[model samples]
Every structure is written in structure tokens, then in C-alpha cells.
Target: MDLKGKTIAILATNGFEQSELEVPRDRLKQAGATVHVISPTAGEIKGWDKKDWGRPVTVDKTLDQVSSSDYDALVLPGGQINPDLLRLEPRALSFIKEVFNAKKVVAAVCHAPWLLIETGIAKGRKMTSYKSIKTDVINAGAAWEDSAVVVDQGIITSRNPGDLEAFSAKIIEEVKEGRHVQRNAA
Candidate 1:
């Protein structure tokens, strides 16, 4: 799908999975979409590598500075701490709700779906996330699956970084299609 003029907001903070954020961000930009990295802070956010923390990514905007009208989609990258922190941030959770309420595309990978659950946006949605979050997803009213990628009602979710390829593709596809309804298709 072509995303020539689309703008995607990526919400993340310290401890986000490095590849989960970077790979999709690069792929989306290559597809002609502008990607903005928004966080709780305005400077930079650190990343979590395989066994240790990694470099920080420059932040484009703070959570307080973001608005659903400023972007076409929202992306939440997961790591142990990333989504955990986001789920507790009122502003961050509210931003996610705004995206869902606006019917805009929202894509999340791995533990990132935790934020979706916290935002109360996972109800009746089918999704996939890190194996450890199976119960969490189910408890949040979403059908949990073990797929590489799942797209339901404009919400895109993946199991982990390993599914980044499929995850990224589905996000672009949904954004281009502009229409999605919850289904167990994936």
C-alpha cells in the first residue's frame, strides 16, 4: 500500500525493543510515510537490546504535545518496560484512546499490546502479542492468537520482533485500505 502523505506516531520510551521500533519505522518511512517518535519526554528515549540496554532514539514530541489529529496512525513498540510505563501514563493511555475513538489505525507489537489493554481498546478485538501476554490479552476481552500478525478493526498486532516484517506490512496495508472490522481472519 502506498502511504505517500501519511504520518504515523510511534509511542515509546526507555526500554523499548530496539528492532521492534527501528525496523518498522524504517520500513514505513521507505513506503513513503512520515514516522514520528513520540515519548513522555522531549529529548531522547533509550532502547533495550538483546541482553542490555541500547542507544537512545531522538524524540520528536512529548506525550503532552501529541494529538490524534496530528497523525494518521499510532504505533506502540514493546519491551518489558516500554509498554508497562506507557500503560501507567495517563496522557499516553489517553492518546491511544483518542486514536481508537477516531477510528485511526493503531499498530502494536509484542508487549506493546499491554498499552492497548490498559487503554480499554482491546475489547472484542483479535490480536497477538508476546506469548507471556496471552492471558493479559484475553482478560482484556481480545481473542488471543499465536499468529505472526493480526489485524482487527484497524488495530494491528504481532507476537514479537520476529514478526516485524509481517507486522510492518499489515500496518501499511491497513493504513492504505482505511477500513477494518474486527474479525478472526489472521
Candidate 2:
């Protein structure tokens, strides 16, 4: 999918899965979209490697400085700490809600869907996330699936880092479509 001229916002804090954020960010940039990393703080956010923490990524903007209308899509990368921190930030949660309310595409991987649950936007949506989160997703009113990638409405979710290939592909597709496909009447 071609994303030329599109802007994607990644909302995260410390402990984001290194590859989850890096891989998709690089891929999105390669697809011709501008990627911005935003968080509640102004400096850099640390990433979590498989066994240990990884390097820090510079934050492009603070949650207070971002508006859902400023970007075409939103991405939330998961690491235990990343989404945990994000869920507690009122501004961050509010920003996420704005994205959903605007009907913009939202792509979340692994534990990141925790933030989606916190935003209360998963009601009646189908999605997938890290295995450990299946119960949480279901409790939030979402139908949890075990697929490599699941797309419901404009929301795209993946199981884990192993699912990045499918996750990345779905993000590109959703961004290219620029709007969610309405469910057909059963």
C-alpha cells in the first residue's frame, strides 16, 4: 500500500518493544509516510529488548502537543512497561480516544492493546494481542482472536513480535485505504 504524504503517530513511553516500534516505523517510512514518536515526556523513550532494555528513541512531541487530526493514523507498540505507563496518562488515553473517535486507523501490537482497552474503544471490536492479554481483551468487550493479525473496523492488532510481518502488512493496507470498511449485513 502506498502511504505517500501520510503522517502516522506512535504513542509510547519507556519499555516499548524495540523491534515492534523500530520495524514498523522503518517500514512505514519506507512506504512514504512520515512517522512521529510521541509520548507524555519530551526527551527520549527507552525500548525493551528480548532479555534486556534497548536504546532510546527521541520523542517528536508530547501528548499535550499532539492532536488526532494532525496525523492520518496511530500506532501503539507493546512492552509491559510501555502500555502500562500510557494507560495511566490521562492525556495519552484521551489522545487515543480522539484517534478512535475520528475514525482513523489504529494499529496495536502485543501488549499495546492494553492501551486500547484503557481507552474503552475495543467494545464490540475484534482484535488479537499477546496471548497473556486474551482475557483482558475479552473483559473489555472485544472478541479476542488468536490470529497472526486481526482487523476490525479501522483497528488492526497482532499477536506479538512474531506477527510483525502480518501486522506490518495490515497497517499498510489500512493506511492506504484511509478509511475503515463498514461491516456488511449478515
Candidate 3:
């Protein structure tokens, strides 16, 4: 299955988990999709690797320059700092809402689901995140599960970096399935 004309957007900021963004990006690219790193900041953003800082990833586009309509899917990579900051940006949160409303695949791993909570679209959906945010995800109305990966409607999630393989595969599968329109209003 080739994704020759597909475009996927990875929304993240400084402190994103290195592998979470890189692995899926590379995997999708290998499958022929155009992958873009869109951030609120310009230039490059540094990644978070375990207990220390990691390599910097180039930002292909800024959040202000793109919209949900420009991509087939949205990927959110988690780190304690990344999604925590992104959720506060009105534009970023709004973009998430637009993507979810459009029924596009919105995949998030680990703490990334926090952004979903901020967009008010996580309610009533089944999801999973890093253990630390279980309560937060549940409080937001999502049915949280401790699984390697979870797909609800078009929202895909995984527990942590360890689940990247499953997470990325699920994203590819969901994007290939096209739009999921049965979700409630955000």
C-alpha cells in the first residue's frame, strides 16, 4: 500500500519525544507520504530523550501557516513539555478541533493526548496515554485503557515510546480507511 500523494502533519514543539516523532515520520515517509513537522516555533525544535535533551528536528511549517485541510492526518508526539505547552496555544488547539471535526485521523502518543483534552474532543472516546495522565484522560471523558495502542473513531493513541511500532501502524491503517464521520461535535 503506497501513500504516494498523502500528506501527514506532525504537530509538536520543543521537548517532544524524539522517537515518537521520528519513527512514525520515517515510517510514513517510507510508505510514500509527505511528512511535515509543524510547530508554533520557527526553525527547529529540540527533542526530549529519556531523562536528557535530544536532537533538534527541523520544523517544516509553522502552525499559523497550515490547516487541517492541508493534510490527511495529524500526529502528536508526547513529552511532558511539548503537549503541555501546545495545549495552551489557541491556534494549536483550534487546529486540533478542526482536524477532529473533519474526521481526519488524529494520532497521539503518551502525553500528547493532553492536547486532545484541551480541544474538548476526547470526551466519550476510548484512548490510552502514559500512566501518569490516566486520570487526566479519564476526567476529560475518554475511556482510558492501558494498552500498547488504541484507536477510537479516528483518534489513535499509544502508551509511550515503547508502543511506537503499534502506534504508527494504527495511524497508517486509519489514514488508509479515510474519514470517520460518526464522532460527536467537539
- Candidate topping lDDT: 3
Model 1 TM-score, 2 decimals: 0.94
Error of 2 at 107 (Å): 0.8
Clashing pairs in model 1? none
Compared with the true structure, what per-residue lDDT tens digits does model 2 show for residues 57-136? 99999988889999989999998889998898999988888888777899999999998898887778898999998999
**How would you order the candidates by lDDT, starting with the best?**
3, 1, 2
The alpha-carbon deviation from the true structure for residue 32 of candidate 2, after best TM-score superposition, in angstroms, is 0.3
Cα lDDT tens digits, model 1, 1-186, are 389989999999999999999999999999999999999889999999979999899999998887889989999999989999888889998888888887889999999999988887788888899999999999999999889999788899999888899899998998998744443222
Worst 10 residues of 1 by lDDT: 177-186
Model 2 regions more than 4 Å off: 181-186
- Greater TM-score among 2 and 3 belongs to 3
C-alpha lDDT score of every prediction, in listed order? 0.89, 0.89, 0.92
> What is residue 177's positional error in candidate 1, in angstroms?
1.0
For candidate 3, list the clashing residue pairs, or say none: none
The order of the candidates by TM-score, greatest first, is 3, 2, 1
Evaluate model 3: give its TM-score.
0.98
Assess candidate 1 and give its lDDT. Answer: 0.89
